[model samples]
Target: MEYYSVDASGYSVKPRGVALPRSVGDVADVVRWAAQNRTPVTARGAGTGLAGGALGDGIILDTSRMDRVRYLDGVVSAGPGARLGAVARLLSGYGRILGPNPSVGPYCSVGGMVATNASGSLSLGYGSIIDNLESVTLVDGRGDVVELPSNRHYSDIISGICRRAGPFPDTTKNSCGYRLDAVPSPDMSHRVVAASEGTLGVVVGARLRTHPAPRRRALAVMRYADARSAAADCPRILECGPVSLEVVGPGIMEGYGGSCVLFAEFHDSVPERGGPDHADRVCGDVRRAAGVRPVMIREGIDRWLAGRNAALSRSLGMTGDRAPSIIEDATVPLERLPDLFDVIRELGERTGSTPVYYGHAGSGNIHVRTPADSRVTEWYLCEVMALGGTITGEHGDGMGRTGFVRRQYGEQNHMLFGLLKDAFDPHHILNPGKILPA
Candidate 1:
């Protein structure tokens, strides 16, 4: 119980007990027991979530024992406890890979990734979990094992919710509240679980779409005077067909010898003879579009991406007194990125906190590291909402952001979310107090 108290988010709340279920039947049994006892059940994965999504004060259902992976046709079906790294290793032998790669790397679980709709730098090209998911199997609050897309009742209920739901943030990725907007129809209702944060059901297994690995890759590191300039040019750089575009703020650029740096990576899936040359040509086009020459260009595979993925950990190691802030995963439209930077600048001016920014710039999602003050966080989130941005992009609205879900989505949408929750978890025992009040 003590071990399940904290996660990468640094927030602690000791659970009453930790339940390790070895199979989907065991999971259903535990959920059933919890519901009958009127105790909350929180489904946990690798416990590497940056938000407080995996933490709860009631029963902590650890799914690590359910690690299983199988491939059929073009989709990979993985158990809730299966680690992303393990799945990737298995898929690599088949020359395929899952699209949404979270920075936590192999340590994060497939279930956690789906729960948060996780996305990495590659999301700029491949899309998020919600986009790649094919189907899902989960145990609802009633202790019933349900396979989505096959459950017509569940699908119709979600489709009704989607029809009545309001518009979501127009961003590349979003993980704020119930992703009702993702369910275009009853057939695609399984997408509603992508970022539901386990309030609706406990994920047992998921079938995800995989992509062919690129034959060649190239990375170009560009330096800019500030994040604003780099962000202002992202829309243009995006035109070069690069697979990923990431930015590092000054706080993390000390070792790179620059104020801000952007990493643009282009991939060649075709095994043509001129793959390297093609990458070079695209790199040159990217440089021309940005109107700046790259500081360094690495052809083929390299470790440059490892550094970018480690930016969050490095920034946290250096935050002496102020821990990593909760107002980190705000994402806006690509065209509104410069305005997002303006908000960060104004936040610094008003609070005297030097915010660190680094994340998927192409998707307009920038992770911020600043002092965690209630008033400052509120003001910053308000500004983000004003700019048509979501409070969280990849990290789900766990305990950390659940209180603000109603504010992010207005009363009508929030009510729709509650209705969806009721339809799935009639007893309200599955991860209570997550997307809605317990």
Candidate 2:
């Protein structure tokens, strides 16, 4: 119970108890028991979530025991508890890979990834979990096992919600509130659960789309005087057609001897037969788009990406007294990224707190680390919204940002989200006090 009280977010809430479910049936049983007792059931994976979505005051359904991976037809079907790293390794054997590889890939679980719509450096090319999800099997609030697409009744309901739901921020990736925009129709209704944060249903299993491994890859590391200049150039760099465009803030750039650095990686699919010349051409295009020469260029991947992948950990390590703010994952329109940096600069001056920024620049998503101040967080979030950005991008609206969901989406969409929650979990037994405010 004590161990179940906290996750990677550093937020803690002691759960009533933890149940290790080995199968979908076991999960259903635990959910049924929770429903009968009128207790909240928060579905948990490896507990690697940074938003504290897995912590609860009621039952904690640990899905780690349900880990299972299978290749069916053409897609990979994985139990919600399956470790992402293990699944990726398995797919590598078949010359395939999962798209949304978060930095916490080695420790995060498949279900957790789906819950947060987890996206990583590769997401610029492969998209997020919502884009790659084929189908989902979950236990709704009523303790009924429901599989999307197969359950037309629920699918129609989701489609109806989609119609009434408000528009989302015009960004590359979003994991805030219910992903109403992603569920365009009944066939794609499963997408709604990609970032629901377990308030809608407890995912038991999921089928994900896989892509063939890139046969050729190139990486270029570019340095800028500040994040704003690097952000200002993201749009042009994106036009050069790179698989991933990542940025490291000055805080994390200390090791690399730069104030701000952008990593642009291009991949060539096996069928394209791209070779050294292709990599050189892409690098040259990226260099021209950047309007400057690169600090380093490599033909292979991972060598330069190692630093970008460790940005979060490095930022955390550097923060001595200042804490990572709840308003970390703000993502604005690509064109407004420079403005976003300007706002951050103003915020730091106004609050007198040093801010660290990093994340998927191609998507206009920037992760900020600053002091824990409610007033500062609210001001920054309001500014982010004013810039047509989401309060959260890849990180879901868990306990940290649940209070701001209505502000992020407005009263109309917040009400619609409530209706959607009712449609799935009428009793509010699934991860109560999460995405929606009580």
Candidate 3:
């Protein structure tokens, strides 16, 4: 029970029962039973979610047993129980890759990625789950089996409700309350379900779009004296088309001879025989190229990438008692990267909490760790929203950011989310009190 109670966020909730379903039919039976008894059902993956999306007070549906990966045309269909690493390994054999990857990597589950619209370092060139998802199979709160995209009647019904939603934030990544605005004219259920955080239904399986693996790649490490200057130069650097552009804060990268360093990579369609590759210029910052130590080998690449993935867990450990602060995953538009860095600095000064800044620089999604109260962090959120940003990106508005979603999307959108909620789970027993008011 303790194992099911907590997630990476440090948030905990005791579920009534833990169900390990081995098949889709078992999952459906559990959902139906929960629906009949008026008990909430929370679909859990590897429990690697940082926002407490999988922790709730009812039934915990552990999808680990049903993990299976199958290839179908341009997409890979997998059970929600499938681990992200297993899917990646399966696709590696075919020279294909999942478009949106969570930095959590192997620990994250396919269902959890879809549940949070997860993205990673290369999300700039690829996209979030909203773009790569093909379809999903789910069991709503009411115990009804539903396959979105295949069920047009309910799709139109939910679309009618979602039509009244408010405008979305003007940023690259968002995982706030019910992204109704993402639903297309004909209603793309897969997109709507991606960031809903299990409020609408329990994800059983998903078909995700895949991309062909790049033939050759080059990586360059760019150092900047000032963090903001490093961010400001991102626009020009992006012009050079780096498939992956990620920032590393001070102390995060040692002996790099700078306060901050950016990892940039470019890919080629075919293997390089010899001569100059796309990573030659370092975005024309020739002085920066003096430290052009590239990660041409597998060991260096894996070691450095490990540091990037460990940011969140490391921050949580370093913060002591003030570990689980709310100033996390504040994403702004690429043009406003400088502004975000400035705001994070101000937040550190005001709250007296250590601020760590690093993320998908190309997408302006910076993860800030400030040891402050949620109420105090609201100030940063307002500033980002004013600059056309999102309060939470990739990390869903679970226990941490649920209170701020109202202001992020306006009250109209919240009302629409309620209407759509009724269409799927009338009893509100599916992941109750998540992405919505309790």
- Report every candidate's CA lDDT: 0.87, 0.85, 0.79
- The superposed Cα distance between candidate 3 and the true structure at residue 351, in angstroms, equals 1.7
lDDT string for model 3 (1-438, tens) is: 999999887698998899999988898899888888888888898988878989998899999998999986869999998988999999998998887878878878989999999998878667899889888988887777789877887788767766776688778788888877787664485578988888888888999998888765666667778778888878876766666788877765557544787877665532332225444443344234333333432125657777777766665665657654653787888888898888888888888865866788888888877677766777888898888898888889888888888888887887888888888888888888788876
- The residue ranges of model 3 lying beyond 4 angstroms of the native Cα positions read 270-276, 281-299
RMSD of model 2, in Å?
A: 1.6
In model 3, pairs of residues that clash are none
Give the top-scoring candidate (lDDT). Answer: 1
Candidate 1 residue-wise lDDT, 314-340, digit = tens: 777656556546547999999999999
Clashes of 2: 0
The model with the greater lDDT, 1 or 2, is: 1
Tens digits of per-residue lDDT, candidate 2, 113-170, equal: 9999999888888899999999999999988999996799999998998899777899
Number of clashing pairs per prediction, in order = 0, 0, 0
Q: Supply the global lDDT for candidate 3.
A: 0.79
In model 1, the number of clashes is: 0
